[model samples]
Target chain A: MEVINIQGTDDTPNVILDKNNNKFEISGRSLPEDVNMFYEPIMDWIDGYAEAPNEKTEFNFKLEYFNTASSKIILDILLKFEEIVESGHDVKIKWHYHEEEEDMLEAGEEYADIVEIPFEYEAYTD
Target chain B: MENSHENHSFLDFAYQLYRTMKTNEISLVYEGEVTQDITKTFTSLTEKSLAKSEESNAVQRKVFNVMVECLQNISKHADALSEEEDERRGIVMVSKGDDCYNIITGNVIKNGKIPGLKENLEQVNSLDKKGLSDLYKKQMKEGRISDKGGAGLGLIDIAKKTGSELSYQFKKISDEVSFFILTSTIRRNN
Candidate 1:
């Protein structure tokens, strides 16, 4: 499958999906005015990627900030990965959050609890 | 050089509001369209101000997070009748009290939306932190998210962050609109 690469902006996250390299990641601050508009394409890409699923997929999320709207979309993205795992594709999620941010950590844990993906949390200090 | 009585009264009203805000110990305020650009500007400005206040990292995060939610609530949910430019105008402020920090936001909402909004706020206010967290997890699992990216999660998140009952008021501005003010508080000790 062809790689899907979208650059990040001040109000949106960067997304990279490559079935060839088995690489997938999203990182940045997400506070789009029209969240559905911003997320639709990524959702489409993920749905397409699921058709020809990669043998192993590791999705990294390094979001420094995101609004509640973006939060819902993030959960949807994680749930899509669950679909891949259900299809016998190996999938994992790495959630990177600031070490001091208990809020972000709990947010990661919340996603991990609802989804079946082997979610690992990596914390960093400033 | 003209000291009209109407102008004097207006100045008095402005001074009264200034005094009220000062008395509330407000550190930040923005009274205009709550656009994405404004959110970024206010968040960064508040970040700098919070740093100067020497607040703990956790407090700063809570304040900033809750502030962002309130601002988004205005941008997403607030309404305007017709195409008036000021219809999108909103009021957002951050005040430091002795016990907690208050993030207050106000915007015009259609009179029709008042009942449902009141119900939603009351439902969220009725829950405690644990209850709110459980509700958040349940909603997340159930995938009750809306197309606009909120399933009443923002209010729940604010309640969770504030650790207190959400406070709000509605002032009827016209037959078609009401000015809605919502305030969430984060305890200083937290």
Candidate 2:
């Protein structure tokens, strides 16, 4: 599959899904007005990638902020990874948040609790 | 002479409104059509203002999140007062109090939607933090997105982030339409 590299905008996030480079990260804000239209292709790409499967998939979520609608989409993305794990593959999520953003950290914890995959949290400072 | 007098009255009214906003410590007040571009502009403006005021990053993020939800709610769900009017028009205001910042939004909605919306807000308000968290997860997993692109989780998420009861009011404008006002508060010290 081809790599998906989308530059971040004021309301959207930067997404990079490259199997060759071993980089799968989504960072920045996500509050797109048309959530479905903005995320459909990314969801489709993941679905296609789940077929071939990497040896050990490590996904990173370095989101500064996301709205409620994007929260649902993020959950969906996590659940998709869980499906890959259920099919006898290794997948881990690296949840990155700012040290001052307890809310973002808690959001990561919530997502970790809801999903069956392992999540490793890392805090950063500006 | 008559036209000049009318112009003078209009200017006086505008000055009075500006004074009221300033006295109330209203940082931003927008009353017009709510669109995607407008949402971006409003959030960016608020973000800059919050940062300038020396608010903590966490509080700024919370305010930005709540404000986005409020503005998107208006853009997605606001109803026209008449059949011919198609634009989504609403009013959004951000005001600062001693301890908390308030995000208030108002828009016209169909009368038939009042009961369901009221019930939903009441249910969201009645839950504790754990209950709200559970509800939010459950809804995220099971609830389908509406035609308007809502995940049915905005209210719950707003309540969760604010950690306060959501206050609201509904005023009947006519037999077919009513104006709905919702206020969500975020404490500065939180």
lDDT of 2 by residue, A1-126 (tens): 799999999999999999988899999999997788899999999999999889899999999989888999999999999999999999999999999998898899899989999999999999
Off by over 4 Å in 2: none
Candidate 2 TM-score versus the reference: 0.98
User: Model 1 chain B, poorest ten-residue lDDT window?
Assistant: B143-152
Error of 2 at B190 (Å): 1.7
lDDT of 1 at B128: 80
TM-score of each: 0.87, 0.98
- Per-residue CA lDDT of model 1 for B135-171, tens digit only, reads 8887666655564455567898888877889999999
Question: How much is the lDDT of residue A1 in candidate 2?
Answer: 74
TM-score of chain A of each: 0.94, 0.98
Positional deviation of residue B86's Cα in model 2 after best superposition, in angstroms = 0.7
DockQ of each model against the real complex? Answer: 0.52, 0.82
Best prediction by TM-score: 2
